[model samples]
Target: MKKLVLSSLIGLCGLSLSAQNVLIGEGSLLRGRGYCEPSISINPRNPDNIVAGAVLDAVFYSTDGGESWIADTMVSSFGVWGDPVLITDTAGHHYYLHLSDPTGENWSSEEILDRIVIQKSTDGGQSWSNGTFTGMAHPKDQDKHWAIVDTSTNAIYITWTQFDDYGSENPEDESNILFSKSLDGGETWSEAIQVNTIPGNCLDNDSTTEGAVPAVGPDGTIYVSWGNRGNLYFSKSTDAGESWTEDKVIAQQPGGWDIDVPGVQRANGMPVTICDRKGRLYVNWVDDREGNYDVWVMHSDDGGENWTDPIRVNDDTGSADQFFTWMCVDPVTNILYAVFYDRRGLEGNHTHVYQARSTDQGESWTNIRITEESFRTNPLVFFGDYNHISAYGGRVRPIWTRIQGLKMGVWTSLWEESRYEGEKD
Candidate 1:
């Protein structure tokens, strides 16, 4: 097991904010030697069994609640590129999804990124199957994919951005959100369908329609949201993936999803949608509407038809930047928790991890710092797109990438509600 890195003592008069931080590994063979943009999952079937994935074919598995991890690389006949997303179904099976470099000649030819590959493991990510793929539109790049498993039906649903000409500035090039599903434990998948009514440019910037993450509601409704051209849109399918509503604007992102931060290469205000046990939908994203980038959240009580105004999740005044936010609602408690990189109480480019909890939907929030020490990022280095979090049964794990000097690594803050007492010890 890795040694305990740091412990953050957030003393609240009436709330407990005790958290322990751990470094999964750095320069480990399991993490493909070097990596970023990590994704993590806590198995619903077994909370002790946790799995994490990172960019460029790196995977880490821990059977003891992330106390220590064994690093390993992922294999697939389709060829693994990057943009790793880890998810789990109700049957105790874990799935790793990523972009593909099938022919191993992505730079030489356009046929390299031929599809999106999914590899499954039934033994807690010990080993993986060959892999199954979807969205195989040649000459098009499939990137930034996120998946959610419907526990009721054991069906997996995914949404992502498909670029006509990746990074092309040509006005003829296009980018759109795509959706697909797998019903047979990843053996096969439904045909990819376009969900966005208006397509964006293919520059993979603010105009690009990207970050389409899907969430399953209590009644089996699949809800998805993304950003483009300064507007955040939402769409849902009551009849599974067979149909979807035209994109509807739920809120204005003001400066659009793509924004420039001081120390990062690229950053965006991509929306993360999550449904609580009561069927209420919650979305979290970053925006500078308040004169600075801050974590904002909005919720819908009556499904995806309507949403409230954006509520600031960070408690600080608008002076520093808060970006790369991810949210999760505990199914057992229905409490909303958000995690993101915060520069509110720091100097220079130093950033810390912070969490906000809302007991009354999006009406009110309590922000707490989770990182004991601060870390800075370099604009010259690619810092990935987002962070990830998973919470169940009062066990919260927030996973993120941290780059100190020349070394970059992934970390998680172990948050257990049981350890929180009204008074600090």
Candidate 2:
């Protein structure tokens, strides 16, 4: 739980905003490995209680908002791998979900990625249960999963990509989005069902059916969106996970989801779905439509039926790339906040983390750089796939990864709603 404090004052659009940046975890960097792919969640009951996760089983908990954090390694009977997704329910219960490696042999064992394992933490992420699992179709692989808790019914829903054969170049191998729900907390889960109509290849690339993030509408309707074959597809399950509507193309991802960003081993433009309190469904992702990657978002007022035109979120005039975007809407204030890696005023692989605040839904954005300073990244080091943000009440915590001196570290900003006066750019 060692703390690395880096505080700064950033000037955005002639407005000076101050934020305290706290480093959650950091470790020595390997050629293609280090701590990255961070996810965060805030408990609505107690905004001070925050929890986040990074790659390879790193768990961080912050009781004093984002000012301080305690880091620990998560373990389970079904071994904890990467792709950590953390979510908190209305009752303040936290759920940590990730891929499993039962044999502890990683890629060497066939049991790796056999299913998605979920661990429940009752005491605000202080400790977790041994864990339960879903989507356990043996011989097939489960990856890239996200979950949402229905506050109305206290039921937890999860969506993920299921591959017939991971990394297989065979044309016959395919990947599809699968979903499951838990009624009694995380004690047990229903049988996993395929929700996507169209399937993609098992290569885990642009054509692969990945990034199926779930969102719950105000009226309890479950909605999900993903990228496949250069199209952003949306689907809904009104009657819970028992049935789902036919996949509808919501947006055309010109450059697909697999983005080629300099100074990173791999990057993704996968879509992230979230619904505000007013039932407005918002989906955020990154794509190279203008020859350079940028964050784009679309909102649907009438569930997943009709959507507004694509709205650029970065608000930068230059063509510097912005990728790996994640969004979340505050239930109390309904303010939409998105975080991503930005290279707007820097050269080459120097990257900075930015946060875009939308007080008027997804219509416009006020972009502000949250990072104290830009860090230069090397393409030889794996930068992970995505960054995450969680907003509860008026508290906003944006989690991201940065490379300094060839070492990787996960960091968060102590950003609050009071810092911004809703001044539109």
Candidate 3:
């Protein structure tokens, strides 16, 4: 039997759940003082085999449906400098993608930030090859990348922000959304193609176009969305990224993607794009549209051509900050799940992890607190930019970073949806 914890944690709303939370990473091997920006993926072919990756150099995998995990260090010839993204192809091959740092330095030279590297592992992320790369332009920096594989064709599509000069304030320096793909497993990739029509300045602020996550529709159409200048923009390609439609402004991000939150060095509400199995599109992000920062979501049934108004995903009516959201949809069931940092029950800088589920599309939602305890966040440390979640076969895993006693760790809850049989939606 499982224990259920019920409480009024979500402001005036009572939250109840039976989540088996698990600590995935800790101790000396986690490296440095902090670990954030985690990525996780569930094998559609074998849901028991789940893989996860984290910033700097960390990879964790489980063969028994996350009952336990094996922590491993990730290394690549291109160098792993954070922004770890993991994905699996139709053939059960897992790939770890991150920004390249050839010299292991802090991107002191142009070549260090010249490419986005990807490493392949055939044996369920046990080992990874040296890796391949795309967008190897000199002096240009590639960051904040995400990938998706079309199970039907085994094609891998990746999208990211390509910077002319990372963190440059010069007017000549610019940033734009770029797309590339690999037709054959992970052997090679096509040349990088610019997907966005409007170029943003390279100030690394709200104006900078970043966070381009790609999703494939039922008919193989590619859809992407990103944040820029207090608004969310979207574009799509029908020919496997050969071309793209002109960008369209989808939603308003009132306070922009970057925001200020107490007890954190930096926080971003960048958009995460996902498409369900039926060709419906959904985009999720955080913003201070209300009195405080909250996770917001929008959906489109027709395609990327239209979108519904922003709906608050967090159930709290209190003025608390909720940021760093990442969303995923179960392809088989079409249920939507989002994970983010929540401060609804805290008095100050303390934070907890919360998840919002929408089974009737975006019409209704239920908020649940997944963390057993709250931890204090420190502004002196970098909390990273985003958290990740992956769900399939009713096995949902939400990965996030936390700080306690000045040490940083990453964790996930082995939340099996079967616990609440008739309570779904």
Residues 1-425, candidate 2: write the lDDT tens digits: 44333223233333366566778878788544678989999999889999999998988887888677777889899999999999998789999999999999999999899999999999988889999999999899999999999989999999999999999999999999999999999899999999999999999898999989999998999999999999999999989879999999999998899988888889999999999999999999988888899999999999988999899999985789998899999889999999999999898888988999998998999898888788987887878888999998889999999888857888888777776554321
Model 2 spans > 4 angstroms off: 1-15, 30-32, 422-425
lDDT of 1 by residue, 1-425 (tens): 23222222232333356676777755433333346788999888898888888877788888888777778888787988888999988888999999898777757867766789999999998889999999999878888899999878999999999999899989998999999999999999999999989899988788899879999988999999999889888899999988999999899897889988998988988999888888889888998998899998888988888788888999898599999999988777777889999998688889988987777877899888888778887787778888898887778888888885567878887787667533344
Better of 2 and 3 by lDDT: 2
* Order of the predicted models by TM-score, top scorer first: 2, 3, 1
* lDDT per model vs. reference: 0.85, 0.90, 0.85
Off by over 4 Å in 3: 1-16, 27-31, 422-425
Residue lDDT tens for model 3, 1-425:
12111112122124445466666765332455566778899988899998888778778788877667777878888887878999998888899998888887765656776799999889987888999999888778888889999878999999999999888989888899999999999899999999999898888789999889999988999999998988899999999999999989998899899889988899899999998887888999999988799998889988877789988899997998898899998877778899999999698899989988989887778888888788988887878888999988677888899886856877887777877444444
**Residue 282 error, candidate 2, Å:** 1.0
Cα TM-score per model: 0.93, 0.95, 0.94
Q: List the residue pairs that clash in candidate 3.
A: none
Please give the distance, in angstroms, between residue 227's alpha carbon in candidate 2 and its true position after superposition.
0.6
